[model samples]
Target chain A: MNLTLKVWRQSGPDDEGRLVRYEIEDVSPDMSFLEMLDVLNERLILAGDDPVAFDHDCREGICGMCSMMIDGVAHGPQKNTTTCQLHMRHYKDGDTIVIEPWRARPFPVVKDLVVDRSAFDRIIQAGGFISVPAGSAPDAHAMPVPKVDADDAFDAATCIGCGACVAACPNGSASLFTAAKITHLGLLPQGQPERGSRARAMVEQMDEEGFGGCTNTGECTAVCPKGIPLDTIARMNADYLRASRKSG
Target chain B: MTATIDRGKATEPVTQIPSRPRRSRRRVSSNSLKAVMAVSGAVLVLFLVLHMAGNLKIFAGAESFNGYAAWLREVGYPLLPHRGLLTLLEAGLVVAIAAHMYSAIVLARRAANARPVKYAAKVKSRADGYATRTMRWGGVIVFFFVIYHLLDMTFGVANPEGHEATPFDRMVAGFDPSRWYITVFYVISVVMVGLHLRHGLWSALQTLGLARRYPVLKASAAGLSALLTLGFLVVPLAITFGVVR
Candidate 1:
């Protein structure tokens, strides 16, 4: 299939970006979206032009590094699938694909189709971890965790940090992302020691990162490549309130 | 042709970017505000019911009605003392209204900015319930009505024709003959208020994380809307029908 690509191109973080057009023909249906882009880059190189830069590692969709806003929807039209897993077959021949980096105040564009997602890292660094001391690995079955609680914790642990939720959100809120982390650790026995402070610290960090407040629009869940549920956010809120109240 | 051949001959290793695990933080500020709205609204509804019931004393003639009013004034508005409790309740009401309005405005703004595509079709299907659909608009209308009501009742503002003064006199004048247009308008406004409270209550609960499952949330939302609508409408209809005079 032949497709026209409108790809965002930027020189650096400080530079303004614009969509530049490129045409690629003879794309195979089986080729993953990234592979097709690889073909286009090969063509660009032959023509003495710079190849389009995008972030991707594992094309298996678990990495969340392959972030792109295709046609205004985060991760394209596919539900619960990342961009790297999306294939050329999703588009018709001669389809004009508009590809751009994630749009958010925190995630600034670094180059073509690649934005610096370090703001998320900073938020995590602020307090998204369990404060366990360094020690020998414990037996796997030592701590007895309820099946239901473990299941909920596992569900919350699936966040991939792609910033797709923020890009999809109108206010660019990071509630879904932050909530998942808070709930995942807060549910475990190991996390109980610092759960209260952790919730407070993470919430304060989230606000400090300048992410907008959650409006319960459910768009985060809709665009989440991992299908992280919005209920996780509710859990985080309850935890935060409890933590803050106790501290107060 | 030479450039293409040279480009094909060149080789570079592909570097892999590591996948970073994202920590999801779901803030329940909106939900918390909704909870506040729901609880406060329920309290307000209770107050309104008792108020209407007290006003029903008019049906027993002037002595009973005025006596009830005098007793209320003398009691210094029990459940809200004239000085301390009244001040506290008034302050709390102001906070609740501010929070509710602030959260609603913010949510509305976010919703307005979130739509990525504009549909060209003339007919659009709405997935939201009737209450959710009209929340912002309904809230605005009710807000304006509340202001007008306070002015009319509390400050002894003249009626549309500038005839009546004092809340007691206005209440008697407004209900004695019960003008058809006034009755219709009052009924409609009260119905809107009911609609607003109904959905607002359930949604507030959901926001507070009380309703986790969608089915549970949906059912509660619908039930609350229906109950508030029915509960609020009963007294107004009674007055309009001369059942409560």
Candidate 2:
């Protein structure tokens, strides 16, 4: 399939960016979205022009490193599919696809489609983990986590931290991402020791990182490639309130 | 061209926390504000439902409707001052409204700061963006509408039909279809309220942590909001149509 691509080109973080159009030929329907971009880059190089830049790794989608806005939707028009995994078949011959970076103050554009997502790192740094003894691992069955609790924890742990939630959010809020982390830890008995501090610390970090507060617009979950449920946000709210009250 | 894979950076990744973790300090998290917003929203929802039920007395004829209106002012009887209960409720309402507006403004400012750069092109990711996009402007309209409603029906200033008249007669005259401008304003306000309530009800449930267990609660929120909106509008529509005149 032949396609026209309108891609955002920014030289650096402080640079003024603009959409540059490129028409490519001999595209394969079976090619993944990244592969099609690879083809475009190859053509650009042959013509001595700069190739379009985007972020991706482990193209299988687990890494969550592949972050780009395809058309309007984060990842792509396909629901629950990452950019690396999005296929060219979703588009038809002569179709036009708009590609751009995740637009957010916290995720500044580094070059083109690559925005600095390190703010997410700082939030996780504040609190998103469990602390245990520095010895041999305990017997997995000794603590006996309830099936329901374990299941809930595991479900929240599935968040890929792809920044799609932030990108897709109308307010650019990272509540879904922060909530997923809080829910993942707070649900586990292993996570109980630091639960109060964890909620307080993470939420504060999220606000400091400049992410917007959750207004329950429901877009974050809609664009989530991992299907991170919106309820994680509710659980985060519950935990934060409890923790703040306890601390106070 | 060789594939320029977004390599795993030597600087550790985020979202997926590593084996080693760091300690953190806490401030009054935004969640505190969210809780306030949720509680205030719930208060407003309860008030709307009650107000809607009170308004429906218009259908019961002049005597009952007027009696109910008068009963509201003297609810606590001789033990408490006349209109004392109503005054107390109004005081509570003022607090709730203030908190709601404050939280909304602060959060909106924070959201804007979060993403300093706007998307170069317009991106409406989903089909249902109308509610989210309209929330702020709709809120502004609703706020002004509430003020105008008080002037029209409470303060006896803006009511062309005369608020000094008995409650039933005032409502009947105010909503008479011949006065299309007033009816138009009333309809716009209610529709905006309906849209606001639709999103607000569900959003409040999530913020208060009431929505985690049952998915059906979303449907209930929508249904309840729609019912309340329709209930509130019935009086004006009926009066305009000459059904209750």
Candidate 3:
């Protein structure tokens, strides 16, 4: 398929970025979106031009490293599919695809379509884990995690830590991602020991990072590849409220 | 292989642990401020519901409508002084509105700061419905309308019948058939409020963590906002059409 690609290009972190158009032909319909970008970069390198730089790994979508806004929608027009998984067949001949990096203060553009997502790591560092001593694995039957709690935890755990939620949110809020991490642990019996502090610490860190507050728009979940429900945000709010009341 | 794995684990460097996580020392967290907005918005919604019901009394004629208005000022008359209860309620509403406005300004600024650079080709998701997009501007319109409404009905300043007129006279003259522009502005403002309430009610439920458990609150939010808006609109329409005059 012959297509027109308008991709964002930036020299560095402090440079002004602009969408540079590229015309490419002979693209296979079976190729993934990232594969098509690879072809473009290969051609650019052969032509002695600077190749477009983007973040991607695992090409299979679970790595959460692939981040780009395809024609404005995160991950592309396909629902529940990351950019790496989006195939070229979704487009037709003579189509013009406008690609850009995630736009959010917490996720600044490093260069081209690559944005720094270390803000997510900082939020996780604040408290996205259960406190456990390293030793032989505990007996499965000894813990006795209820089926429902385990199921809920697994559901929340499905978040891949992609910045799509922030990219998609009008407020550029990281609430959905923060809430997902909070819910993943807040539901388990093992997570109860420091649940209050965990909620307080992570939420404070999320705020300190200059991320916007959630307005319950559900845009983040609508574009979420894992389909994390908006209820996780409510759970986060519940936990935060409980923690605040106790602290008071 | 197991021994090698254990050896690797033994050689792993132990990272330094940070100090214990501190409790929230900030006077107000983000969600807490949102809760304040939600609670205050909920109070305003309740007041609107009651106000709509009172307006509906116009169908019973001027005597009944004016009497109800008089009773508002007469309640706890000897104990609390004339219009004392009404004054207290007005003061409470003012405080609620002030809190709501304060939170909105701060949160809007934070939202702006969160995305300093705008998306070049951003598209609105399906979930970002019309009501959601119009919230900020709709809120401003509602704020202005409330001031105009106070001058026209409560203060009797903008009423055609002047300040000496009875409550019913002021309301009737406010929406006289000849003054169709006022009625049009009233309709537009009321609809804006309805739109604001539609999104605000559901957003409030989410912030308060109620919608997650009762997902049905989303539908109730829409239904209640529509009902209250219709109730408020009926009185003005009735007066303008000479049905209640």
Q: What lDDT is obtained when candidate 1 is compared to the true structure?
A: 0.71
The residue-level lDDT of candidate 2 at A6 comes to: 92
Q: On lDDT, who's better, 2 or 3?
A: 3
lDDT of 3 by residue, A1-248 (tens): 99999999998887998999999999999999999999999999999999999999898978899988988899999999999999999999999999999998888788899888878888899995677765889776987888988998999899998889999998899999999999899899788988988988888888877789888888999889888889899888888888888997
Candidate 2, DockQ to 2 decimals? Answer: 0.46
Per-candidate Cα lDDT values, in order, are: 0.71, 0.84, 0.88
Superposed by TM-score, candidate 1 places the C-alpha of residue B7 at a distance from the truth, in angstroms, of 22
Give the per-residue lDDT digits (tens) of candidate 3, residues B139-186. 999999999998998888888998889888899999999998999999
**A228 in model 1: Cα distance from truth in Å?**
1.1
User: What's model 2's overall lDDT?
Assistant: 0.84
lDDT, candidate 2, residue A146? 86
* Positional deviation of residue A247's Cα in model 2 after best superposition, in angstroms: 1.7
**DockQ-based CAPRI category assigned to the predicted complex of candidate 2:** acceptable
Best by DockQ: 3
Model 3's CAPRI class? acceptable
Q: TM-score for every candidate vs. truth?
A: 0.73, 0.92, 0.93
Lowest lDDT 10-residue stretch of candidate 1 chain B: B118-127
Better of 2 and 3 by DockQ: 3
- Pick by DockQ: 1 or 2, better one: 2
Better candidate number, 1 or 2, judged by lDDT: 2
Ranking of all predicted structures according to TM-score, beginning with the best and ending with the worst: 3, 2, 1
